[model samples]
Target: MALLDIKGIDVSYGKSLTVKNCSIALDPAKICSVVGESGSGKTTVIRAVLGLLPGGGSVTAGDIVYENRSLLKLSKGEWRSLRGRDISMIFQDSGAMMNQTRLIGKSFVEYIRTHESISKQDAWKKGAEMLGRMRLPDPDRIMNSYPFQLSGGMRQRVGIAMGMTYQPRLLLADEPTSALDVTTQAQIVRQMMELRDEYGTSIIIVTHDIGVAAYMADHVVVMKDGRIEDQGERGYILNDSTNAYTRKLIKAVPSLGGKRYV
Candidate 1:
């Protein structure tokens, strides 16, 4: 059975229908990438699954199921229990999402305590260990620093470390690398792939970069104007898809010296 299934969901922001009849099924340990231009509703789909829709936004129809349970029917208390332990999310700019006034260690420790019953000292040690696993040097010093003290790459790694703390069954990343430089982007992408390999975590990544999608996803879903324009296995979407929009996006990928990156 699929680890997560989104069935014919229509999402709305107040009266405006933003996502229509979207469906996706992700199996255990698989990576699925949703690619689309801005406002195409790719982010909206994942946000709905995580129940993090904006204040006025909501899933108006159909259902989201995770591990045989209906996520749409979960209560606030149930969702609180499920979010950090079973499913975690990494945002576009993790540093920006953090409280700048607080030290990174403080935020991380609080985050850990929220999902697990642990003392402050134990949580701090665990958080440092996770940061070390993500390859950040001198994890102890990192814990003492504030988010702004670290570079963009470092901040993103910290986000990944926190998200992977519980070894969640599913991870949702929304344009997680968009705010970083090329080298940082590559590092973050590689790290995410490594997490999947190490923990067998299923991932759903939302990105506008088709090249990244092709490189990281087992399945590629192309969205346009609030609907899925095309979807299939990576090879099919990359080489065999006849959909005009999909073809156009693929062709738009940058090439250097006659070699296309994807």
Candidate 2:
């Protein structure tokens, strides 16, 4: 069975519908990219998967099944038990997601304890270990520093480390690299790929950059105006697209390494 199955979903803000009849699935140890322009309802899908959509944004139809259970039907308490341990998300702006008043080490340690009944010292050690895995130098200093003290790249790394610390089965990344520089973006993407290689985590990424998608995704789903424009394997989306929207997106991305979007 697939690790994630989002079937025939319809989402809405107020009475207006977004993400109509959307369906996608991800297997273990794979990355799926959802690509689209701004306002194409990519964020809506991610929010729905995380069960965090607010302001009357409801799932009008369909269900999200992760690891064979329906997430849409899960109670609030169930979600609290499952979210950080079974699923985790890394957002676009990592620093913004953090608390400025607290040191990262303190918050990270607390997060670990919330999910597992581990000693505070053990949680701190685990947090430091994750930071090191992300290739951060001096994990202790980073843990001691406030969110604002770190660079954008460092902050994003911290977010990734924290999210992946529990080794969740599903990872939802919403424009995770959109806020980083080109070099940092490449580094983070490489780390994410390594995360999948090492832990076999299933990932869903929402992105506008086709280059990043092509580099990272095994399967790609293209969206436009709150609906799927096209979807297929990475090779198919790049080489045999029948839809104009997909072709346009392919042409917009710059060449990566030796691979061209043509």
Candidate 3:
């Protein structure tokens, strides 16, 4: 069985349905990308996977089975337990999700303690280790500083490090590189790939950039207006697309070969 099986899911905001019979399965040790424009329900798919949909919004119909467990039936407490330990998410805006006043090290240490029965000192050590793994220079200093003190790329790295701290079986990234420059974006993508290589973690990345999806995803799902436009392997989507929407998306990105021979 797949690590995460989402079958025939329909999400509704009030009486109106936003997502219509969406379905995708994610395997362990692989990366899947969900690409679509804003308001296309791509983010909603990931939110439902994480069980973080808004209060009024509900899963009108679906089954989210993670590790053979039915996530749709899980209680709030049970979902909370699964969140950080079994699954984690790295958001687009790192600071928005973080405590403004707390230092990175202090917050990370506390987060580790909550998930595992570890001493504060040990948690600090582990947090520093993860920051180092993300190639954060002077890890100690970055950890000691608050979220505001770091640049957008630096804060995003910290967010990624924290999410991977427990080696979650599933990792969700929501527009992770949107706030970064091109160079920084490339670096972050490489780091995330390395994380999967090292830990064998399953990943679901939601983004608008097809280039990023091409570089990072084993499988790609294209979404439009709350429905799936196309879903397939990267090679197939890049080389042979039957859908017009998917074709336009692929063509919109600039080529990296310095000259457009095509």
Quick one: best TM-score, which candidate? Answer: 1
| Ordered list by lDDT, greatest first | 1, 2, 3
lDDT of each: 0.94, 0.92, 0.91
Q: Count the backbone clashes (under 3 Å) in each candidate.
A: 0, 0, 0
Which is the leading candidate under lDDT?
1
Candidate 1: count of backbone clashes, pairs at least 3 residues apart or interchain: 0
Evaluation by lDDT, superior candidate among 1 and 3: 1
- Residue 18, candidate 1: Cα error in Å is 0.3
Better candidate by TM-score, 1 or 3: 1
Q: What digit string (tens of lDDT, one per residue) describes model 3 on residues 80-185?
A: 7899888999999887798999998999998998878988999999999988977889999988898999999889999998998889999999999998999999
Model 3 alpha-carbon drift over 4 Å, by segment: 257-262
Residue 68 C-alpha lDDT in model 2: 83
Task: Tell me the TM-score of each prediction against the true structure.
Answer: 0.97, 0.96, 0.95
Global local distance difference test of model 2: 0.92
Span of ten consecutive residues with least summed lDDT in model 3: 253-262
Could you give the candidate ranking by TM-score, starting with the highest?
A: 1, 2, 3
Candidate 1 lDDT by residue in tens digits, 1-262: 9999999999999999999999999999999999999999999999999999999999999999999999999999999999988999999988988899999999999999999899999999999999998898999998999999999988999999999999999999999999999999999999999989999999999999887888999999999999999999999999999999999889888866655555
